[model samples]
Target: MNKVLLIIQREYLTRVRKRSFIVMIFVVPLLIFAMGAIIALVAKDSDKLSSEQVVNVVDESNIFSDKFHDVKNIKFKPVKASLEQLQVAAKTNESLLILSIPADYDKKNVVKVFSKKKPSLLITDEIGRQMNDIAVNNSMLQHHIDPVIVKSIKSNIAVNAVELTDTGAKDANVGPNMAVGIACAILIYISLFIYGAQVMRGVIEEKTSRIIEVIISSVKPFQLMLGKIIGVGLVGLTQFGAWIILSVISTKIAGEAFNSPQGSMMGALAVLQTIPFGYILGCFLFYFLSGYLLYSALFAAVGSAVDSETETQQFMFPITLPLFFTYILSVSVLFRAPDSALAVWLSIIPFTSPVAMMVRIPFGVPGWQLALSMFMMVAGFLFTTWVAARIYRVGVLMYGKKASFKELGKWFFYKE
Candidate 1:
């Protein structure tokens, strides 16, 4: 136990003292802020960034002669020139498009569009909508019906979701919940890969340099593997803790800079208050640690069996496939139907529970299901650690031989 503690101390200090680690701890939050700033700037100035496009219309139908109007980045002008002339003009003007409405447009309900380049969906859709509205209004007039009456009959509805709890009923912030769920799942998915790979790389480095040979004389392979995993896992937790603190400080500073009664800060805080951040944070920490432990053990085993980083690829894919699968399903399927059978099973399965369960947490998972998932995660971690220790005990001493799946199986079953 003392030796494992010493190993853990050594591993943690060695990484935490590195310049790269310190740089990343501070740089990541700044990068996130910069990205947000860039997106906001672009959104605020989108109209200035986009050039207006001109559309030359040849409306032989004559119904839309004076109806075409200019919108944000598009201008419509009725032209007497034929389609061939418009096409010729469009070839010289890259920002110009030609729209042709045949005399029989009412029958075919189709209009031909030509451009030097493929037009944007926004422009095309706007044009289609305007033309359709005109055609519909014309038909209504022919039938002696008023378009205003039809427009007045249209309705827009807004729905407010309310969740019922044992205490009472409260408003549910569905958008924020979905965002938080997806964000937590993605963070866990990324952390598992980042920290797990760190363990494998650290093991491979020590083995390749023959440092493991000297260390093994004092400590068993299992102790060393466990210490390395825990040490690296702590490093991940530290980084995440730092990120949360820094993000909060940054957000507070920004909010103060733009503070007002009706400002975004107040609105954001109101939205955040409705979310169960404490519960979500607790689940995230549990799953992140459990998932890291479960995957890092396998990563350490892979490191032991391989001589170099390149050799780890063959074993990494199968280990990582479940993470990818669950992440995709969590975003696409689980968010929409958190109570679905497939989601329930995915959240309970040890291999996928980390991401799957995090995605379901914000949507309010049942207590029994959450407990069962947590239990399975612990079991999965223990099972993988035991198997990895068996492989690690033999593979650290192996050298100059390429390990295959069959070789790894033999190592796993080797006698003490």
Candidate 2:
């Protein structure tokens, strides 16, 4: 245990003290800020450059004179000309479209649109809406009904969901819930690959240099693997924690500098305050650690069996496949039906629980399910650690020969 602690200390300090790690901690946020600024500038310039699509309207009925309206990127130009003349003129400009409303449009209600280029869906939809509104008003007038009174009666419905928990009712908006859940899943996904790979590489590097032989004289292979995994895990936690704090500070500063009372920053801040960040962040930490440990043990075993990083590809696929598959399902499927049977099974399964459970957290999963997932994840890592330790004891001393599934299986049955 003491030796393992020593190894953990060595691993953690070596990475944290590196110049590259320190530089990235500060530089990444600045780059993100710069990128946002560039995007905002481009959006502002685009507004000036954008021109509205002009549509030539030939309203023969004259009753629909004020029906056509101009919106952000669409303009209606009423013309006193025949369809033939308008069609001929439309050939000159691709952006110009011609709409002909015939005299008998009241009976047939057929409006023909002529254009050199196909008009966008937005322009077509808006024209249809305006024409429909005018037709409805005309019909109401003929029937001696007031269209204004009918319009006033239309109402917009807003539904706010609140979950009734044992403690109390909590706000349950799907939008924020999905956002936080997806975000937590992404963090887990990234950290598992980044830090887990670090552990694998660290083990492989030491083995290649024959450092493991000397270290083995003092510590057991299981202890060494455990130590490396824990050390790298702590480093990941530290780096991620720092990044969160820095990002919050940087965002607040940027918000103050760029936002006025009427600016988007104020609106963003308002939205941010509504999010249940304390719960989200807490769940993120739990999933991140559990997911990392569960995978890192397997990664450690892969590192030990292989002679070099290039030799690791075959072994890595099986280990990473579950994570990749579950992440895709979490995004594509779980978001739609979070409480579905498939989601429940995946969340309970030890191999995928780390990512699957996190994806379900913001959707308000039951307490028993959450507890079961956590328990299974802990058990998963323990089993993997034992298996990895067995492989590590023999594979660390191995050299030159490539490992296979058959050999890895045989190693598991070997006496400790």
Candidate 3:
């Protein structure tokens, strides 16, 4: 235990003292903010571009009783003369081109688009299309089409979302689900990237600098591996807690900046302040740590298995496949049914539940279900850590030889 503590202290302090870590902890968040702002600004310009498009709506349906001001970004030109007059005006510099709905337009036939030249991008033929559809649909209705089917076809479909609670008086909203899902995803991505890379770089550094010899002299191989994994995992958590604090502060400031629309801050703070939050957040922190430990230990095993970065990729994606696949499927199914058998089953799978459970929790899960999920996660994490330690014990000493999946599996079964 003392040896493990020494290893943890060494790993944590070494990483914390590095300039790169110092820079990244501060710079990355600012970069994220800048990128978000730039995207918003570009979208604002795109909205203005939609307004810039000038389309002359020539309604030749002749049944037109009112002005066409309701058409978005469309200009209405009521024709007093022939279609010939409009075509002549269309050829002018007023607008690049035009699509004219003909007066003789048969409702059952193709609508004709009259243009002197090909329509420029600044011109939209959407109004022309909509008018043609309206005319055709009007014809169908005039022929007395089935009203029931017509109404059903035109009606909007909505899915009812509700939470089944045992005793809680309050109901869950989509806002919390969305916020928690997004937060959980962010946490998972950051932990995996940060800790996984730490494992890789640690292996590479030890292999290159011959520091493994000194470390091996003092502690057993698996003990050393456990220490490094735990130490870095702690570093990950410390930074994660700091980031959560910073983000909460940022959210508060943003709310003030934006006037806290619909009492968003108060609602968020209210939820955070609840007594159950301690348990919920405790579950989050524990699962996050355990999940990272499981994955990062394997990353260490992979790093020790390989001599260089190029060879590392061959092992990395296969490891992350479970995390990515689980997250996608969890999010996809959360809307269809958050409490279904599928959701219930997935949240129990350890590799998946780090993300899957977090997404489902905001929607509410039964007590036994949450307990079972935590049990599976802890058990799975312990099992993976043991396997990784065995791999590390052997692979760390091996030099110049590449480790194969088959070879690694063989190591796991070896009687040491």
Which numbered prediction scores highest in TM-score against the true structure?
Answer: 1
The stretch of ten residues in a row with the least summed lDDT in candidate 1 is: 104-113
Worst lDDT 10-window in candidate 2: 267-276
- Each candidate structure's TM-score, on Cα atoms with residue i matched to residue i, is 0.91, 0.75, 0.74
Quality of model 1 by C-alpha lDDT? 0.92
Candidate 1 ranges with C-alpha deviation above 4 Å: 59-66, 100-112
Candidate 2: stretches off by over 4 Å: 32-155, 163-173, 251-264
Q: Model 3: what TM-score? A: 0.74
List, residue by residue over 1-416, the lDDT tens digit for candidate 1. Answer: 99999989988999999999999999999998899789998999998987888888899989985797799988998899888988988899888898889888866647878999999898889988999899899999999999999999989999999999899999899999999999999999999999999999999999999999999999999999999999999999999999989988887787787778798767886788789878898899999999999999999999999999999989999988998999999989899999899999999988899999998899889999999999999999999999999999998889999999999999988888
Model 3 Cα shift for residue 353 (angstroms): 1.5
Q: Write the number of the candidate with greater lDDT, choosing between 1 and 2.
A: 1
Q: Candidate 2 residues 1-416, lDDT tens each?
A: 79989999999999999998898888877776789889989988864666788888888888775677788877888888788977887789787788888888767648878899887777788888998899899999999999999999989999988877788996666787787788788778878999999999999999999999999999989999999999999998988888889989987886888688888888777667767788878878887898899899999999999989999999999999998999999988898899999999999898888788888888878989988888988899888888888988899999988999999988878887
How many residue pairs clash in model 2? Answer: 0
Q: What TM-score would you give candidate 1 relative to the actual structure?
A: 0.91
Q: 312 in model 3: Cα distance from truth in Å?
A: 1.6
